[model samples]
Target: MAIYHFEAKMISRGTGRSVVAAAAYASCSKIYNDYDGMMHDYTRKHGCVYSEIFLPSNAPPEWQDRTELWNAVEAAEKAKDSRLARELIVALPVEIGLDEWKAILKDFISKQCVNKGMCADVSIHDTDGHNPHAHILLTMRPIDDKGKWQAKTQKEYLCKRGDEERGFTAAEFKTAQADGWEKQYQYKVDKKKLYMTPTEAEQQGYERVSKNPKSTRYGRQNPICAEWNSEEQVLRWRKAWEGVTNKALEQNSIDARVDCRSFKECGIDEQPTIHEGVSAHIIEQRGGVSERCEMNRQIKADNALLLEIKKQIKKLSAIVVDKVKKTVLDFANTLENLRNRYIFNRYEITQNENISTELKQYNTTIDVTVQRYNGIVQQLDNKITELKKMKAEQKHLNPIHIFRHKELTEHIDKTEKEIKKLQNLKSAFLDKMSCKSEKDIPQY
Candidate 1:
C-alpha cells in the first residue's frame, strides 16, 4: 500500500547544524566543508540507493558535485547564524518503481527549485522495505545570470523627504537623494534620543551622537527568496507531492490514494496515529513491543468501540415497538453518567481497515438477530389478542380447551419476556464497550 508523508525543515547555523554534514549523510558519501575546514564523511551509513545534484541553467557546472555545491553554499554565507539549506523528506509510493519515482522527483525539483534559480541535492533511501522516502537539500541563495552567488538581502537605508520617511536601497537612494531626501541619524536632543536629518539637528543645536544611519532591521530580503521561505510555499509543496503521487498510483491502476489534509481538516473526529519509524516497527516484529505501537493499538481499539456505538444509536430510530423502546429506556437508566463513554488517549488514529470492516460485519449480525427477536415478540402479542377474543365469544368452552389456552398463553408471554431480556443485554454490551469497561457486561 502507498502512504502519504511530506516533511520539511531547515538546516541552519543558528541551530548548530551544518549543510556539509547534512549533504554527506544524504548522499551516503564523504564531503569536505571549506568554510569550517572539516571533512564530513558518512561512507559507513547505509541505505542511500540514489543521490544527485541539480543546478540552475546559469549555475556553475562544477556544482554538479555534492561537495562543490554544498561547499559553495557554506562559503557564500558570512553570518554565523545564517540559514544554510532547506530540507524536505517525502514518502515514495510503492506502486511506482524507484527509477520512476526518481524521475517524478526530478520533475518536481526542476520546476519548483532549479527553474527558480535554486540548486537541489536529492537522495532516496529504502533501508527497510516498508518505509521508502527521499531526502532533498536545497540551496537557500539564488544564482545570477553570470553564475555568481547573489546576495540574500540588501541594506535599505531610512531617509526623510519633507515630513515623510521611507526606506530606499543604494540604487534607489541615488535617485531619491536628488528629490531632497536626507539620511536620518540618531541625535541627542536635551536628554532624549531622536531621529533627525543632520541639517535639521544642526539647526536645532542637537548633537549627532551616532555615526550609523538608521536602516531596516535585517535589510530587505530578495523577493523570490522571501517567497520560497514563506509558510504558504511549504503548503504548496505538500499538496504538490500528494498530487504527483496520486497520479502515479492511478497510472499503475492502484485503487489506494493518499490525502494531504489532516484528520481535523477532513472533519474527522478520530485521532490520527503517530509515525512509528523503522526501528519501532522492527522491534514489534521481533517478538517485542514498542511504546508507539502499543499506543497506536489502544487508539485503534477505542476508535472501533466509538464507531460501534454510533452505528447502534442510528439503528435505534428504526425500532418503533413499545417493548423495544421500554427496554432501551431501562438500559439507559442503568448508567449514572453518560460522560464516561468517550476516552481520549495519546497517539494518532491508525488506519486499521480490517478491524473496521470486521466490526461493521459484527454489528450487522447483531442487528439481524435483534430484528428476528422483535418479529417473534410481535407474533406472540397477536396470538394472545386472538385468544382473549375467542374466550369472550365462546359460551362454554371445553374444560380441556380453556386449560390448554391458559397454558399456551402463559408459554407465549414467557418466551416474549426472554426475548426482551436478550435485547436488553445487547444494549448493555454496547455501553460496556463505549465506556471501555467490563463492569456492565453479563457473564452469560
Candidate 2:
C-alpha cells in the first residue's frame, strides 16, 4: 500500500544543528561548513539513490552545488538563534520505480520551494526495499533579483499621525524643549573663494539643501511576508507532497493513491495504526516478533472480526426480511378470508343475535395476528440495532483494517439499506391494519 508520511522540522543554530552536517548525511558525501570551519564527511554512508539542489531562476548558478549553497546560507545568517534550513522528511511509494520517485520529488520541490524563492536540496534514500524516503533541505530566507540573500526580518518604525512629537523616541520626548524635539542640521559650502553655511548660502540666494531627520520610538522587527514559518504553510507543503506522489502513481498506472488527511477529515471512523518503521519491519523479516509485529497481528485479528460481523449482519438481514414478508402475507390472507366469510354468513347471522360473537371472534383473531407481527418486528429491530452498533465499533479499529475490509464495508451498507426497507414495509402494513374498513387491508 502507498502510505502517506511527511514530517517537517527546522535546522536551527539555537538547537546546535549544522546544516552542512545534515547535507553530508543526506547526500552521503563530504562537505565543509565554512561557518564553523569543520568538515562533514559521510562518504562511507550508503543507500543514497539521488541528490540534487534546486534553486530559483534568479539565484546564483553556483548554488546548484551542495557545498557552496549551504555554505552561502551559513554565511548569510549571522544571529546565534538563526534558522539555518527547513527540513522535510517524506516517505516515497516503494511500489514505484527509482526514476519515478525522483521525478515526483523534483516536481514537488520545483513547485513548492524553488518557485517560492527558496532553494531546495533533495535526497532520496532506499537502503532496503522496505524503506524508501526522501529528505529535503530548504532555505528559509528569500533571494532578491540580484541573487543576494534578503533579510528574513526588517525593522519598521511606527509613528503617530497628526502629532507634533510624532516618531519621537521616548527619551527624546522627555527631553524636548518648547520646539517639541524637531531636527536641525548645519551644512557648509565652499564656492567663489569663500566658505558659507547653508543658511548664509540661502540668504545669498545660492542653491542650498538641508537634511530633515525623523524620530521614532523603538523599532519593531517582523518576518518578511513571503517567509514560510507558520503552521498553515507547513500543512500546505505537506498536502502538496501528497498531490505530487499521487500524480506520479497515476502516471505509472498504479492503483494506489496517497492522502495527507486525518481519518476524521477523510470521513473515516477508524483510528490510524502506529507506523511500523524500517527497524521494526527489518526485525520482523528476520523471524523476530517485535512489538509492532504483535500489534499488526492484533490488527489482523480485528479485521477478521470486522468481516465476520459484516457477514452476520448480512445473514440476519436476510432472515428478518423473509420473516417479515411471510408475516405480512399471512396477515393479509387471514384478513381477506375473514372478510369473505363474514359477508357470506351475514344473511344467516342476521337471523340470530349472535352476530356480535362472530365479530368479537374476528377481532380476537386480528389481535393475535398483530401481536405475532409486532413480536417479529421487535426482534428484527433489536438485531438490526445490534448490527449497527457492531459496525460503529469497527470505526475505532485501525485504519489499515478498515482499508482492507472495503468490500465488507459495502456489504454492511447494503444490509443496512435492506433492513431499513423492511422496517418501512412493516410500518406500512401495520398502518393498513388499523384501517376501519376491511377493503382497506393492504395486500402483500
Which candidate's TM-score is highest? 1
> Candidate 2, which ten residues in sequence have the lowest lDDT sum?
156-165
TM-score of each: 0.71, 0.54
Per-residue lDDT for 319-410 in model 1, tens only? 77876877587446533223244323321333344455676697777666556544655665675566556555443546667776676667
TM-score of 2: 0.54
Evaluate model 1: give its TM-score.
0.71
Q: What is the C-alpha lDDT of each candidate?
A: 0.80, 0.74
Q: In candidate 2, what are the lDDT values of residues 57-88, reduced to their tens digit?
A: 99999998999999998999898988899999
Identify the runs in model 1 with alpha carbons over 4 angstroms from their true place.
205-207, 278-295, 323-444
Model 2 off-target regions past 4 Å? 162-227, 275-444
